[model samples]
Target: MFGAHTWRCGQRYDETMTLTLAPDVQHHAANAAGRDFVIGDLHGCVDALRYLLHKVGFDAAHDRLFSVGDLVDRGDQCEEALALLDKPWFYAVLGNHEDSLCAVAEGRLARHRWYAIGGGWAQGLSDHALATYAKRLRELPLVRVVGEGETRFNVLHAEFFGDDADLDAGRFDAEVRERMMWGRELAFNAARLPHYALSPTYCGHTPVRELRQIGSQTFIDTGAFIPEGRLTMVEALTSRQWSISVQAARAMGAAEMTLP
Candidate 1:
């Protein structure tokens, strides 16, 4: 339960605080239809996204694409990246970067803090564009769940710290919610693995040298913002993973600009 504080994303929480989680997949296409795929942190690299989508034969009319959030920042195409939110085939779970942006828009966080965290690209937006993006960011859920039977998958921005029994119960509160969006201890600390009842959780936020798997969780941020990094994607049902190198992406005209 949230303490006495103002709320922004529907649920009640302190405006000065942060949190995160979600489960429900009734909207995805059936197995007979196109596949469901998840992509890593996309920090404004729409070109890289386009290349990876092509490589995977992504059919926007059939296949579904889910982003692990951080879709805007540290790259040049933040405006272009927002196009995914309006696409019928695309879905996304909120990441900490998005949270920061939201906080800034809500006047809960300083513009400097957002700028400090690779959000300078937002300054280029028109008034309408900024409002549009802020509204969309506010509307994004903290989590997205898909699959059934024995292959259920939970997509969140960061780590899930709730008890396994609470996974499907939809009982995430403000504190746990913040952890899901910003927590790194569970994603990076190999020795502190907690047994999440939900198997095969896919998340990003804490960038890794590669897609890392600890227990039932998988971290796929892959540092796409770095020149040496690449955009990573995975077929949820088959566990077939693919990556598009930053250099390759640049060669394909995906690297017009970058952030440090």
Candidate 2:
């Protein structure tokens, strides 16, 4: 029932009747043919980031990427770091560093504390860039999301709420606080996420010797900022699958992105 036509080099076939594919598989194949990938964290490693994207064949023109958070501070490429993430297709959450920027600016935090944690990088920043990053950081939501394919994930620089304490009422300023300022407590404490009952959460901040999965949760931070430069990336279409980047390309993706 199919038809075929000989062309320049090969033959083009019309599979109107020749072959059949299940609806789900067909949909999966079609939708996931090429899609954007969401990455966990990047501490200003612009070259590594570019290498990773290049290796994965991620066409930035049509596809999109979502980063958990942390665009600057303590990294080798803070200026370049923010620039790389300035694209419309790229979406990210407000990271702890961003939070610190405001806190330090407002005098809520001591200058010593800020520098101790890499805030010194901002010293070289132009006033305009500083203002811009501050404005953007304030607008950043706590989460970055990828809600399609077999992979559905929520990314945060830190937790939605403190574990021992409750954002449900008063937690961060009242009961308990975490110095790391990432999402471990929130992931552990949140009762249930009706929307993500089937999906897993991907986060950074907690470095593991090896990337691991529990139930359906995923930990992606290997502390690339440290000497090892170990980082992990998961395919945007496949849930519960991850690859560690060696040349940075090892964690590559095969999709395109549409600027957000």
lDDT digits (tens) for residues 137-186 of candidate 1: 76677767676656567788878866444666656666777777777778
Leading candidate by TM-score: 1
Error of 1 at 257 (Å): 17
Per-model TM-score, in order, reads: 0.84, 0.65
- Whole-model lDDT, model 2: 0.51
Candidate 2 TM-score versus the reference: 0.65
- What is the lDDT of every predicted structure here? 0.72, 0.51
Q: Write the per-residue lDDT of candidate 2 for residues 97-154, one digit (tens) a residue.
A: 6666656554456656767877788776655666566544555544444454355455
